[model samples]
Target chain A: MMSANTDFTLAVEELTVSFDGFKAVDNLNFYLDKNELHVVIGPNGAGKTTVLDLICGKTKSTSGSIKFMNKELTKLSEHEIVRAGVGRKFQTPSIYENLTVFENLEVSYPRGRGVFGSLMFKRDAEVENKILEIAKEIMLDHMLETEAALLSHGQKQWLEIGMLLIQDPQLLMLDEPVAGMSVKEREQTAELLNKISAGRSVLVIEHDMEFVAQIAHKVTVLHQGKILASGDMDTVQKDPKVIEVYLGH
Target chain B: MSFMYEKLLGGKNGTVGFVLLATLILVVFPLALDGFRLNLVAKYLTYAFPAISLVLLWGYGGTLSLGQGIFFGLGGYGMAMFLKLEASSPENTAIQSTPGIPDFMDWNQLTALPWFWEPFNSFTFTLLAILIIPSVFAYLIGVAMFKRRVGGVYFAIITQVVSLILTVLIVGQQGYTGGINGITDLRTLHGWDITSDFAKNLFYFITCFLLLAVILMSRFILTSKFGRLLLAMRDKEDRVRFSGYDVANFKIFIFCFSAMISAIGGAMFTLSVGFMSPSFVGIVPSIEMVIFAAVGGRLSLIGAVYGCLLINFGKTAFSESFPELWLFLMGGLFIAVVMFFPNGLAGLWEDHSHHIKKRLGFITSLFSKNDTAAVAPKLEGSN
Candidate 1:
């Protein structure tokens, strides 16, 4: 994995997102280096998800520039950003319950963004082989043909991660990837994230400090729509403001 | 192989069998019924057009359109005007004249046919009117509503109001609209001898074929990726919009498609029964279309067809057996279905089949050496 101190892969300058009259993410500035697994910790309503939403174009930043690999991201739509190699997993599993594990990957394939394109498109063997290979890596190869809804919650989370892997995105933003996972599943997910971060950047929004300490190379603490601290998990967890925010002081 | 089988047979062997049986019954129905009854069924099928429209709008698109009757009325009234003109010719003066001037001319009391009404006097013109008028209206309404981002109950209310306004305008201009009596005493439809048994059967067959074709088309659309996007839109409209899909365009396309379907049904209705009335295009009938779709299972294409058939069948049977109790029974049935089977009959069938499968599996497991122990380890591991 690339070192956290390497040159930035994603740079956000003065990013702000407001809903109604209240600002959800206010003038937040951050930069992520390539292959870095950055954990964003925030108390409830701290705008961690809002930041991810803005980055994925699910919510537009009011006035700011988001540069991904030096390319402007603010003008792109969510689907366009997805096609441009940015994958997102929602807090809730967004996988199609009726579709099989393999079919879920197929639906997110980058080639079918257009209506006419999808209608005429056929899945090539290369795409199929790649999906299977990724599923195997995620320990989901056996469940390829199983309906997504029938999968266990932890399995569903892994399957969603596998889907993002299939998309082959440069950056993957996952919201609460292991929120409902068991201890073993959380460890497995952390291992999977470590393996994935070898070739890509991963921004995980999580509240679990132990899980963050396990895999996060660097952590940023968000409070009331602003960054309170940024450093290694031990250092940030020990920060007075971070402790007070978590304890509702 | 299982996927292919499920896709072709609609998930189960029994479902395919039942569909085949239903198709056979419909094919043979016209032969058993008298001409009058066959004609009524044909008319009901025509009404199914608007119901199908409601299915597309409400079932798939998640837009409950209460203005389908407006489009239906447009087609019906358009055809009625032309038929009235043809029947009121100098050579046919012996036939009964309307109480006042023909309904189309009553509002203005024009001595000469309006430029717009002039073309409708021809069968070809009337046919064109049926297709164009409803489609144009749908396009305008769709553009206005969608561009403004008016949706949900707001959309439903707007559409309902549109139909309501049309009904009032038509009824208030009794001279031009035939008022409450509506256009009746129809005759030949483009010299087809509509009163003849052969023509009635032909119309019935045509209606059945149209219904089948539209159902098939709807199925084709609903199974495609566009259909998935539509469902995604229903579940997460904001997500779809953010995904860069032209949500407004999609709404307009679906709304217009539904209106066209409804208009065709209306034209068939007028042709078969030889009458066009304001009641056919009012809020009540529009609401009835939504009810049909709801009862049928709004998510399934086949459900729409089944719902139309079931509702119309009940209407016919109840009216004949106990006329006074018909409306009460229908209302009660609606309430019962809504309260007990929120997903409607399709969901009931699914739940029943799942239970049957569970029972069968349990029985099979009792005879086998390996059962609970084999599956339990994996279940525990997953947890």
Candidate 2:
């Protein structure tokens, strides 16, 4: 099973992490194929975020391997993981508040990752054009000059998505991309996620099942650091175990 | 008008501040004050370097270093060592048992020049050391601390301890380091009499030029993508790291850069004041340097200079008469700045500059009203 598999973009095999004695993400085997929009839904303490954390190198796994494009991710640092074509958006809208919307997207551009490279990084046409395109995609083109701090809750959320979009990652992981957004904003975000997940793999941790049904190509219901159900949205929704542990709420 | 702003890294207000600072330091200060007072102002300007460096390190980078005096002392001591070596020429020190070593070394019974001091005999080496040594030291410290993710108040406390340790080391080693009194009587630079009023004025211009050049260089950095990243890292370290930026690298770079800037100021302080003492390299001076940044508006580079000037002038004036009250006053001023004027003088200026500009524009418009003869707003348009 561990034989170099190029079929999947991300393959997490026997991934287990424990904080002292408590296992946060227990021996989990997860696979994400190219262009698949996968959603991980779980109740509180189910270690939904812990899985994302382990995959993204934010938290080190006690044992097991996470391979992205067959590259070992467990040993790589967080920034190195990001540079390896993986982008993770936090549960909250994390953005540079002092900077304008244009700057927010511009800062996320993939070029000039080195120390001096960033110092000499110019806002040339290629960069400007890319920022403009991503800004439009995220519906932030009109508010490009606005300070991120002044943006509405939903706009800030979109702004963060746009930041990740600017990186053009092969794998995008968002934790509750529409947690605090309005319903209308949620619908728009669902639309945005579906549209952007065409070429790259998208892994999302969300609780909104209706919103999940709208976007998930595949769904995995996590229960106490273990996958209780995994399949298409409809099948997972109908599963008795998923219903008892998660949907029953 | 905005197009012109685009040409300069800081845009309109930044360029204006740069020019205003230049004029004040290079022109107004020299012409307004006598040579003696001008020399004192130059000495004050040396302190401004560390303050300005703090603006970048603390204000933008979000790393508060309480031991800037370490780098400042390094630069000062580097310069002092060279001057002491020069002053201790065989002819100048013929009375000592050892004719060529420093007076402190002779007093402490040193027979030969220490290996470290031998390199300082070369002027080029001394200048390079002044620029490089502090940055290297900071780089090592930055790596040790930042890589380990030791920051916030703990990082600050560690730096304070480092500065305290340095001060103790310098004072204890009376033979090698000039001790608590510091290296003194720097007579000349390249055989020219630096102690004279003529040299004082000359060094003043040189310091001003160096200060302005560095400010421009910093402005360039502050306007770059790196600058934006600094703000990003400050706000969200994890976000920046996930954004593919090695957060520690940026912190280390800024830390090292700020140290180099502080060292330049230290070297200048030694040159202008003709002394490098342990008193200037300890926790008190380090904290005072931080206060200078705070008072000037840590976020504003030029404000840092003004902060240094304002606080130092306050220090000199209040301390002269009510010597005991100076510390209390300084503490009061810091608290006031933090409470009310958190942005410092620069933020205050930034907050009100627009209103002032509008009022000035109104005054100018009043005077020019008769010349343009422009019509008032059209009230006749159909609503």
Candidate 3:
């Protein structure tokens, strides 16, 4: 199912992913608009994270077409997909724990990606300022020199986000951005996501309905590898199928 | 000056450590040791190349190769071939059936120089072959393995097998490669007899200089951003890949780079030892080379040099007195270093560096009572 539309930032048409005989994501159709903050909500085993994996090219789709900015995504590898301006933060806080917070962010800086480029790369004023700016944005300015493993759970999540921000991708996809965070951290992350969404599209897979309601411009409910409902949060929450399968249960 | 010191030596204490090492190798060793001892030190320095390569490959890049000896052997053979050809000049080998060919070829009843031996007649081509051949092998292995996601223990095992294969091949192909004895009777390099004591002394100085230069180059890479990326990749491969880097390319480059460095050491080894042999191109020597890096601090380039020197010195002395016990002692040393000091000597130094600095300050204070800037904190804190 190919989408002829070029207006959408990300368009997935009839996406299906299967492991052995079981379908993880089946015939999924989704689209993300420019500068939109979209949240995916679902019950356990409903494939909310699978959709993200499919989008980020972490899982190969059995049958589908994923077009990111009018370019076919299924043909590209994971790193190529990332270079194509899609940044994904995993469910767990995946960060370089041994390195300092500053080093973690510096790794994701868009420049010096080439082998020789990295060799010649200097921590010049521009790079230093960018790292400091991102550190400040993530509220980690004071801890830039601290090792990442020492960061609190919430801080690690933010550090991973800061890593993504350093790259400044056109689209940011986060899986469970506030799963293990405290209430205060959740609130801070919501604010951070809102600020970041000003110039970029965000696709968040979140189970916390309260967190979703706080920052989501639109929400989609997935059930057993398909989009059960899609609309504004209020409308989708009230829908009978959405209530029966997800929120009500 | 401070920036340069910090960048080159790692930090203030690192500068002290670096200076101590430089003085020991460059100034102290040359002056204190006799010619024979000096030549022995040069031989030890040759092994340091493989150890230093491990600092980059296994220590920083987290790519462990168990077959560095293969690269070393290839490089040694490359140099040996040239030396053998030079020594077997038509005038020198006039008594043999093959007057222009290496004596080994004549001994094996070959009347003609083999096609492969033709290029080694030129010293320049041999030098190029030494640097490039092993790296090409490493590149192939790296691309084949890393691209397909074969790594960790599996990579180590494959490299070990490669060392075994090369050893067997060199031993089996006696006529072509000088067999198990290897390419011996290497007399001269471009008409200068390398076996001469004066030439040995000169080569010793050259080897020391090259080893020092390698340390500097390694230090430069370790301090660079690329080095940081290697650390990043070692910690989290997936994250680096997701950050838009072709991870295989980095692994391949590092493996090839390590091979080239090991090759340099191998060439140096042939020059100093005066022969190349299959005894060096096997699993045991390969594993021993890794131990040198491990004991010296696999993460520290300078430490690798010291490790190579210390272990070789120990092996020479220990084996002479108690040959059977030396093997057991070596095994014990490996286990102890692995278990007790995972980071090795450098790690040990780093752990107590503050105390060492304080002691240094205290010693200085005894000499000059007003030297409070260095010892004030310790003195006041103690009081």
Candidate 4:
């Protein structure tokens, strides 16, 4: 793992998001270092997902400045954020269920995500080969031709991860990555995250303590739209406030 | 084999088969049917145009527009005005003095044609009016509605009001619009004798080819990324907006395209029926177009064509047999289709055939394997 004192990859300053006169995320501030696997855990309605939404440009921050690699992210659209190397996976698998696994990965490629790209059937062999290679690395080669809907819940989640990997984003924000996954699948996901964290900055939103411990190098606990605590897993887990909110005190 | 059968039955091939069947029936009907039936079929083809537009807007674009009839009316009026001007008296001096010039003008005691109606005297001007007026109206309404993010049921209601307003305006304009009776007695189009069989046949062919072209164009759009984006918009509009697409622009484009298509259908209908009237472009007819699309299969392009033919044919048959219960029958059909087959008839076929073959193959294989096992046991025991 990279040293703990490395330069920040993502920096947020006083981010707030409001909807219909009600604030969802309020005056949040955080910084994620390069090659760090960070976890954001909180109770329901704690603005964890909303923070990710702001970062991914799904929801514009009411008032804030988000800088990624010293570039302002507030003005960028979702596709622009994606092009700038930020990948996000929704709580539910947001893949094309009718398409084959390989086709799903192929569709996630930056070029294929646009209007003209979807119409034309032209194939970039290098991209295809890379996708195939990634699918193989994720042990999805056998299921490459299978429709995404037919895959098990665990496989679908993995396929979504593989899709994000193909985009080759500099930062990945995964929401509840292991919500419905089996124990074995959870371990595999943890291992996958560990493998990818070597070169990329990962912000994982997970509730499972064991899964977070296995992969997260640093953790931030959010409660009611504010950060309650932030530190390494052991430090955050021992915090009385973190325990009372996340786990029964 | 069963798997292959399932693939063939459930896949795009089924859609192709349906399209091919429709083309065959349309091509052969004129040859076998008498002139009256041929004319009715031609009328159905023209009606199919508006339905086709609805399919693109509602079925594919996911915007349920109820004001398509307004565009249709505009096109019809445009053509009617030009044709009436052409058939007017040669001595231009009488054009201003005659109060009973077009009967409606006499009823209202009007002195001269409306200024707006003057330009429509030329065929070229009328044709341009047919395309431009409806498109501009749709574009303006679409921009306003979409910019405000007013969609779904709100959009439907607004469009309904638009059609209602248009119908009332046309009906109240007794002097120029021919009042509730609307402008009729369209004897000729660009000097072609519309009453002649050759002209009718020529128009019928034109309608058929145009319908085919629209269907192909819609299919192309549906298969493209824009189509997928539209579907995404339908599935989740906010997600699409967040995905960096200009949702309002897409909506406006589709609305304009739909209006243009509906206008073409309207022009064809006027030419074929030899009249343009308020009744044909009223609120009821607008709703009927929605029913045509809904009954056929909203998502299927072929379904739109099928729906138009089926409903029109059923209407003709029922009205002739029992006019009072015709509405009841249509209502019942819609209710039954909606309650039982949510995906419509096309969806029903897609779901059934694949599973049926798989079950049949499984049963046959099971019995054959059991017989083989029984013979093997008997042979082993005998040995």
Candidate 5:
């Protein structure tokens, strides 16, 4: 028990990634407790998304380790890490444009992931009902038959979140889930995020302070690949270093 | 019921397209063309196998391979090797210095049969080799490229390079491969005289039936969950990867599956055409095979078959009188398909289908109203 941080859903320690003599993420230590909705806010080029990429195994670290569920994630492949119950949403809306909303959700249903498994996968009532449940949860039930290409910008964002939600990942890392959303859409998204984070660890990288204050249980401000200030939203906002680097701008 | 129909066959429209192609090949071509011409069509249909495969790999899987001819040639050469060996019995080759070996090996001054060629003597081995050999080759290439994340045009160029290497290997090793002339003088398959007109006709029907089955198999893949995943991976590879899929595995499976399909066509090509040459195993034929897929409708499997039939018929027709201009025309057709008709022939059909239905009001009345309503929005959405 002393060897592992079982209380934390994710414990990233001494993580560093260097490219061409420049360390993009430099020995950063971050931790998330169970059911904690932690937000990472930083200016552009602050290695915010890089941290997400590192945790999800999209980008390999030069040193240090990322432990999730007492399992070292840095050594696993991207899909292997994902299969271990960690879902990541990109900053941009990355839903499949050519697929229908139903198909887009169905592809992420977390079953039949292997090549042969997918070929033999039958769409039973369980799958159908699950897709329907997620679609409705994401507020895209009416657009199930509609192609994702026709969805609005906000709807596309929700659909991307829906894609991650269907996986039922233990740790959900979202990169700016409301970047292009309208006020109404953002409100719905905040509510959706709140509902989903009830029993799971949620890590978000957001720029919008209002949305951050809306959904964040705790906030961590990153500056140049290192944590500058980490605490509740009020504490992060009041930190002189955070105001100087990010919030002031 | 409509969903069920769509599930089995692509949609109601696809069912029509399948039947239409079926009638054109099975019923119409045999009734219309003579034996010699029909055999020519059979040769053209072999190219359709690669074209149909491209629709699955390039169109749906979104991996453009310009070296399908390599797999086709592998299949052709495998069959040709067996046939050449069978034709080179001690009794037939008693005149040669070395009997019981391929004549080319004898001409090149080889005394014994190569160890590798021994297994090919069995017909069972040749049949299995047609499916397994190319799949293994494709699997190797798929792992080398897809695992390393080398895709799009880079992947295309590597496949072309593979075809070139295969061609050089075949032409360079004259004795074992029969060199540039290819392993010719093929006479029989399992003691049946394949050179006979009856055999040619039987082979034609076999080609058509085999092609239909291939199309159905490809459709089954496309409609399955794996099919949707392929399309998703094509559009958003990162998303698919993050969605808990080993994306490389999917690409490898499709590539191997696509290679096997092309190899089947290649084997048929040897049977129908009586020879496998380096000319058909190089970069040129490989790219030409892609043109067939592009012109047919890269997205539509049935369209790929028609594309092959149409382009190959044109190649045979124009090359006879204006051989010098045919290459230019082929090049021009590929450019035109890429520049303008990105989706190819079937795309045109889908785009204007509603209009065509409306124009023929009397005929369209026979179709269900719900079908038209169902497909109308799809047009505007895809484009």
Candidate 6:
């Protein structure tokens, strides 16, 4: 087993990704500490999500090393990276719309994930209890049997979070978790993020600075496929390069 | 009783439909139809196996394989090879130059039985081959394409090509596979005459029993968490992958399972019909199998069975009277089904069954307040 580095739960070094002739991410370095919530803020096409995709093995980095717990993640497949203790929720709420809330959580419960194992799996008391517990945490306890498509936009976002929680990953990466949510929903999501980040690390790509200020322990401002500024929200907001490249626009 | 009925048949209406279907096949058909017509029904029901497989693979998994007939043909050939060997006993083949070899081998100037065909001499090996060969073939295809994440129309096109290749291979290798005519004159199975009326009836019963078993097995899979995962994968494959499933493995398993079930149908086809032909192992029959599933309701297992029977019955009836119009009519049916009833007959039934059930319940309440008062509330609550 690769020992989990106490200082850094995740570390990326010299990451570069170029699609065709245009470089989406260039020479990027990022890190997240244990129990810390790190936010990546940038304009559209600033490669904020691409960096998360690189760490989670969703996009192939042209040149880089992403180490999750001191183990290189770029060499692994998306599913393997997930099993290695990194969870990702997409930019859009990617919950199973046709399935019930209970089923959505049940699928992402992270046990019996193989083909034959899944076929023979039974919902035991322990699994049921865990599902209910997560449902309560996501504030969907009463809607467990309701189809996810019927869920409000904010509820779908929470359900996706609940899905990632069931996997119990040490690192949770959420892309634009508060996008399209109402102000109240954003506040609740902020609280939910802070509550869930007690023991694990969180990496969020968010456009909502207010939500980021509420939850982000450290903020990295990206500009033109590079990290233009890195500091606390107040410090990054004051950084002249960040202001000119992102906030000024 | 209600729990078992719902579990097995899918719901209350499903249970009623199942009971009606069961009675029609087991009681009414035997009593009403003569031997000739009964045999024809048995032949048609043999198709339900492939149709049910399509429901599991294409309907649920969202992997459309157009080479189902390849598996079907492999199964048919497996059983036919065994029966052909039995019929071509040394005494029976004494007139041929190769007295112990099948007649086709003699006609093709082959002196010895092929080594591959030697295994078919054993009934156990033939049965196992019927289940295993097609699954192995399907496994290879599934792995090659799914591992690389090739799907959608590309997968469908490749499967169609595979069935075409199999047909050409069978036709070209006449000496080995009995060619265009196929392995015919399969008179017996272990010295028992399969052509006899009593044996035909027995095989028909066995076929129906096995078809029911397969249907139940399919229903069990479709209701399981595995089935839900399949639906999730169909909708958002990346989400399923990130949820820690090797997506290719699930596709492979379902593909192989579908192939095995389709093969069983092919085996039964050989036994009841006493022949196995390349015509059933090609692109045309494969697409026909898809149509059966589509018309029945790709998502409905019971619907697939009825779809196969209805289509086959129409084909037989139309071809007998209006042979020239059969092709055009089939084409029209395919288009109409796809355009108007995308979910097939089963979807149509489910659409209106709620209102039908409600009306029926109200009528029943008029007749007897106690039963409707008890049943009506439960039905409303479930919806």
**Interface RMSD score of each model:** 3.5, 0.6, 1.0, 3.9, 0.5, 0.7
Check candidate 5 and list the clashing pairs. Answer: none
User: Tens digit of lDDT per residue, candidate 3, span B1-383?
Assistant: 75576566677666776778778888899899998888889889899999999999999999888999999899889999999988888999999987988877888988888899999889889999999999999999999999998999999999999999999998887888999989898888877889998988888878887777777677777777778889988988888888888888888988898898899999998999899999988999899889999999989888898889989999989999999999899889999999878888887767556556667776766664554465566545333
| Per-model RMSD to reference | 6.1, 5.5, 4.4, 7.2, 3.6, 4.4
Q: Which digits, one per residue and each the tens of the lDDT, describe model 4 over residues A1-249?
A: 112322679988888889998888888889999999999998889989999999998788899888887777889877678778888888887766756787667656555455445555345688779889879767799988898789988888888888788878889889999989999999988988999888989999998989999999999999988999999999998899878877774
Clashing pairs in 1: B103-B176
True-contact fraction for model 4? 0.16
Estimate the TM-score for candidate 6: 0.94
lDDT of 2 by residue, B1-383 (tens): 54335434388778888889999998899989999888888888998888988899999999999999999999999999999999999999999999999998999999999998999999999999999999999999999999988999998999999999999999999999878889987898889888888888988998999898878778888888999999998898888999998888899999999999999999998888888899889999999999999999999999999999998888888888999999999999999999878898987776566445545565778675533233222112111
**Tens digit per residue, CA lDDT, model 3, A133-196:** 9999999999999999999999999999999999999889999999899999999999999999
Off by over 4 Å in 1: A1-9, A18-21, A69-85, A114-134, A163-166, A231-249, B1-22, B78-108, B118-136, B139-150, B173-186, B235-252, B320-324, B347-383
Q: DockQ-based ranking, best first? A: 5, 2, 6, 3, 4, 1
Can you give the DockQ of every candidate in the order shown? Answer: 0.22, 0.86, 0.73, 0.29, 0.92, 0.80
Worst 10 residues of 2 chain A by lDDT: A1-10
Best by lDDT: 5
Candidate 4: tens digits of C-alpha lDDT, residues B38-99: 88888887777788788879987789988788888887778787777765644422544563
User: What is the TM-score ranking, best to worst?
Assistant: 5, 2, 6, 3, 4, 1
> Candidate 6, residues B1-383: lDDT per residue as tens digits?
75356445667766677777777778888889888888888888888899999999999999898989999999999999999999999999999998999999999999999999998899999999999999999999999999999998999999999999999999999999999999999898777789999998888888888888888778777776789998999888999999888999999999999999999999999988889999999999999999999999998888999899999999999999999998898889989888878889898787557557766777766675665566666556334
Candidate 3 scores an fnat of 0.69
- Reference-based lDDT, residue A6, model 3: 85
Q: Candidate 5 at residue B361, lDDT?
A: 67
Evaluate residue B232 in candidate 2 and report its C-alpha lDDT on the 0 to 100 scale. 90
Q: Which stretches in model 5 have alpha-carbon errors above 4 Å?
A: A1-5, B1-8, B358-383
Worst 10 residues of 1 chain B by lDDT: B94-103
* Residue A191 displacement in candidate 6 (angstroms): 1.1
